[model samples]
Target chain A: MKIGFIGTGKMGYPMAQNLLASGKELFIYNRTKEKADPLAAFGAKILGCPKEVAASSDVVITMLANDEALLEITAGSEGLIHGLHEEGIHLSMSTVSPKVIQEIQSMHAAKNQILVSAPVFGRPDAAARKELWIITAGPLEAVRKCHPIFQALGRGYSNFGEEPARANIVKILGNFLIMTVIEALSESFSLAQRAKILPQDFLSAINQALFRSPLYENYGQLIVKKAFSEPGFTLQLGFKDATMARDLVESYRVPMPYLDVVYWRFLSALNHGKAELDFAAISSEVFDSWEDHPPLK
Target chain B: MKIGFIGTGKMGYPMAQNLLASGKELFIYNRTKEKADPLAAFGAKILGCPKEVAASSDVVITMLANDEALLEITAGSEGLIHGLHEEGIHLSMSTVSPKVIQEIQSMHAAKNQILVSAPVFGRPDAAARKELWIITAGPLEAVRKCHPIFQALGRGYSNFGEEPARANIVKILGNFLIMTVIEALSESFSLAQRAKILPQDFLSAINQALFRSPLYENYGQLIVKKAFSEPGFTLQLGFKDATMARDLVESYRVPMPYLDVVYWRFLSALNHGKAELDFAAISSEVFDSWEDHPPLK
Candidate 1:
């Protein structure tokens, strides 16, 4: 089966390369065409646009940045909807909103095609290692047909059922959970610094004795050292995820009161011109906002 | 060394047993007295009051419930302070306020005695296994002298310098961080359930991928199952810790905006009569308070 891939940014580039390595005939596209040039070395064809990629492949996957990019590539003029043939499937691996996926699913349904929501859980590093978690949902037949494709891109897959937006919802909530953890680490590190305990000592103790997790170890070290200059995931994108989570929570009518704090911190980080820094930069914001250091009130 | 053990409750009982088994001459006291009875077989002498235990022993350890209990046992007219010798040191393992610990320290100083704050991190199960993390702070010589006692009672110890209240601050902040995590997990689980995904599935994926820690694994399962009963640590005590954290934050003049959310949720849990349940029961509160479930706004 032929596979077309779109949006070859940091995450998508490595993911598409893995798909090509798995012996799939791959057609790739990126807004900045140069981003897809590296994958051409392995005999993958670089297409010009999403529409062009869609026309030549039975299964087309889009791994764009946000809801806007996903929408433009899937539903805009010169988009995938104009080119995908009947019985074709458009698999989305972008972390976008459920609403966008729902809209795209309707657009695909109109053309007698399938749209599968299969947003993944992993950083670009995990993507390079082919260690992502493919959270998938759509028609059962479509998911089953794409199982081999999922295997090529990720370590494993969890099917969230037939409704395409279910996968998007899960992905959004998962990202929200991650931001909440980062905020927790930020606040604790801030408090540790204020209390005259080194953030390193506090993080070391908790990581060893209680929170023995990669999330803590990785983010804890980054936060303790205030190493946010290089972006693993930028603060701006982290803020976008936080905003989307707030929207989802509001739509669900759930009182996620703590999320308000996460949203505020992310926005503050961006406001302080930390848009290019790692999301863990929120720790510095947290530490700075403490009213006074030692002799508090 | 003659050791005085006060408050033989869930944590104190096992800790006292470990000390007794380590061949220390132990004098144990509990308000109800019966709770200390089990230690008698191991040659422990069950005394009538905190005063009696303190009068008979050189180094005393108190592991009561809260600030009030700690205050009464340490400073009330019939308390340990009135009974101890001039050079005696009181080691407090209960989770209480930095303010309360400082007050108790000053009271001990007035009597030419010493108080060492050495709160622990572990559940009753870990306490039984002697794997608790003992966090200590006091005079350097005093903490050094109690090294063997802490070793017998815990897997390891971290000394936070000579300020007796420093250990209390760290314990309070550590508990606050744990509550923040529980609240984050609850919010995510509530959202996952709303999205028609199983909390177990969401938890399992995150645990395997990012949060590879016992804190997430243990508490995530309990919250997912709504198995908050049988009290690993009760909602009531959790609320107390959150309240103390707020106090500490206010005293330190630092703003922990997220903790306001945690404080409110813990109070809500207690108000909903989950006072006797495990702290993970906050997940239930989070689920119940959702304005509507499937048909959100």
Candidate 2:
């Protein structure tokens, strides 16, 4: 099947490259154009707009930055909706709101086209290595048709059934869980530092006894070393995900007290102009407030 | 060396049995003498009181309910402090506050006896299997003397160096981390339920993609099945640990917003007469609050 990929940013660039490496015939588009230009070296056809990429392929995948970008590229006058043929499929891999994807699915259905929500769980490095875990939802036929595409870019995939928006809710809640972990680590590590316990030693003890997970070990190391200079996932994106979670839960009338704390931490970090740093940098907010408090040793 | 085991409760019973099975000469005591009477079957000597237990053994291990019990048993007129010989060691394994342990340590030092904080991580089942993870801090020589005891009762141990209270701090922080996870799972599972997603499916997906830890999987299963009848770790004890964490961090001026959320969850669960249920029952509070709201789709 002919495939089209859009949004050649940090996560998208590597994902699209993997599609080409898997020997898929690919058409690519990026608003900046320059970002998409590099994929041509890997035998991908560079298109001028989302509509052009849509016209050239049977299945189009959009991995844009946020809700607005996703909506504009998929439904604008020059969007994919204006160019794809009947029975054409649009696989959305963006971390946008569930409501937006549900609305976009209706728009595609009006033209006899399909939209599938398949947000991923991994960073840019995971994307580059084709190890992203994809969570998908849409019509069974549409999802099955895109399996080859999922296989080309991800290590494995979980289908959340046919509503299409269920996948987005799962993705948002998953990100919320991760942020809570980061917040918990920050608070405990800060307390440990104040008590004069070495952060590394504290991490080793707790991880060995309780967690025994790479998620905690990696994030713990990042916070311990204050390694926020390199961005695996930016603080801005983390804030965006947190905002989406807050909005979604509010609409559902579900009380997520833990999300509120991490949401505030992300907002405070963003306001301090640390949006470009890794989201693990949220720990700095915990450590920074301890300037006046000396160790208890 | 002769060993004394105090507080023959759910955890202490199996731990004492392991020491006896390891061929140690065991002296046992409990507030209710009936609890310690059973250990006599395994070649243990049932003692009259904490004082008699301490007087007969070179080292004593206390695993009790709360800080009050720990302080009362160690410092009262007929307490271990009044009878432990000079150079004897007291190994505390209860989940109590660092301040209480430090104060008791000073009292032990004045009497020419040693105190070592050696709190543990595991439920009763783990204790029964000798699979607990012990965290220790005290004088080097005192800790070395307790190695055979640790090996008899635990899978492994991590020493936090001198200052017996440091081990208690690590233990409290570790419990705090576990509670944060319980709260996170509670909120996310609540949201998933309202969104027409099965709790088991949500748990499986997140555990596979993100956590991959038995800690999350076991607790997630408990929360999903609403199986809070059997207490692995009771909600009441969870509140005690949370309260200690709150008091400890406040004393250090470290803000732990996430802990504040879970702390409230534990308190709410306890007030609702859920003190005897598993701590994962904190999820019941989230689901109970949702009775007024209907599920979407």
Candidate 3:
């Protein structure tokens, strides 16, 4: 099978590498040429633009950073829709909004192509291990047609049926849950620490109790250790997902007061010039009010 | 050990019933005499007032509803302190605030008695199964001394150390997390339903995904089925916990924005007359918003 992988950044590189190692004819395109250079060792064809890549592959997978990049890359001369074979599928696995996915679907349909959204849930480390949980929504036949590359890129797939954008919505909401956990833990711990309980002790009890969520355990570790330099997902993206979630809520008239509070926290972190840090770093703002308090014994 | 258990409501009844079935010298007290009647058949000494119950027992366990009931029963003329003996252990296992626990502890201490705070986590069903996860904090010796009773009342006990009031805070925070999950799930479902996705589908994804905290799964059933009548904890208490959690945050100089949002959601439900309904009934407000539009399909 001829496959084309685009935007080989953090998540995309490993995914594209996996596809290349599958012994399929892999054509790659990247906004930055350096990312595509490494795959040439595996006999992967490096296409300079989307049009060239689309002309040569049976499938074009978009693993861009966010909605903006995805839209930018698809709306102009170098876009994915103009590059794919007439019958090819664009398996989009980026974290994006449902409306954006619907737009891509509409555009792709106009071009007589298919856009299958398959946003993934896993950190960069998980992606490197091929341990990511991938969710797809599109035609069942198209999903089946692209199984080999999907299997190569991810551990497993959850098909939410033919409206592929629904998968993107689910993925963003899932990310929203993670960020919500971070914000709640940060605020609660600051509260507990003020009440003379150690933040670590509070986290330990919560992690050990029925509220044992991976999001809590992982982000709680970062908050406890105060590690915010690097992240599985950057603070910027975390804020973006929160905004997307809030947007969806606004459109639906479902009040996201929790996300609203969290949105401001994200904005604080963004305004504080820590957008490049881990999303868990938002906990720092939570602890700001207690900066002068004696540490809990 | 001669033990006194005050309050025999849904939680108290099962917890006290479990204690009595364990072959302890148990004295039971309830505002209503009917509740204490059934336990009397099982070797319990049913008492009329908190004084009689405390006077006849070496250790008094307050499991009453609300901080008010607990305060009154323990502070009334026939209250726990009114009859407490020197060196008697006043073990409070109710869900309440840390300040209240500290207040009661000081009052009991001045009376030459030792108070231990041992707030529990688990639903009525868990209480019935005797599988409650008890978060205990108090003097090490006191918690150790009360181990047999603790074991009898729940699956196990986790010693959170010598600060008895800390356990009350832990229990409160745990409830806070459960409430966050409820609110998050409620809002997410509202968004999903507006987006024309099935509530059942969205809930199943949450249950199966990393967001699958037992809190979500349990509340997901309530929200999924829209079964909000016949309160277990009651939305009023949910509101109180939210307010208490908010007070805890503000006291410590931390702003709990998300919790504040959820607090008022419960408050709005209260204002809308959902005081007696299940806290899950807050979903009704979210459901009501989508009554006319018929979410986009």
Q: How close is every model to the real structure, measured as TM-score?
A: 0.91, 0.95, 0.91
lDDT value, residue A53 of candidate 2: 91
lDDT (C-alpha) at residue A274 in model 1: 90
The DockQ for candidate 3, computed on C-alphas, is: 0.38
- Each candidate's DockQ: 0.56, 0.55, 0.38
Chain B TM-score per candidate, please. Answer: 0.96, 0.97, 0.94
lDDT of 1 by residue, B118-236 (tens): 99999898998888998889999988889889889888888888998888877887888788878888888888887777888888877765677888889888888888768878888
Number of clashes found in candidate 1: 1
- Compose the digit string of candidate 2's lDDT tens values, residues B1-297: 999999999899999999999999999889999988988998999988899999999999999999899999999878999889999999999999998998999999999999999999999999999989999999999999999999999989999999999999999999999988888898998889888898899998888778878888888898889999989788989888999998987788887888888877887888899999988888788888785667453
Give the top-scoring candidate (lDDT): 2
User: What does TM-score give for chain A of every model?
Assistant: 0.96, 0.97, 0.93
Using DockQ as the measure, what is the rank order of every candidate, best first?
Answer: 1, 2, 3
With candidate 3 superimposed using the best TM-score fit, by how many Å does residue B237's alpha carbon deviate from the native? Answer: 1.6
The CA lDDT at B68 in model 3 is: 83
Locate the minimum summed-lDDT window of 10 residues in model 3 chain B: B206-215
Instruction: Point out where model 2 deviates above 4 Å.
Output: A294-297, B295-297
Give the least accurate 10-residue stretch of model 1 chain A, judged by summed lDDT: A288-297
TM-score of the first chain in candidate 1 relative to the native first chain: 0.96
lDDT of each: 0.86, 0.91, 0.81
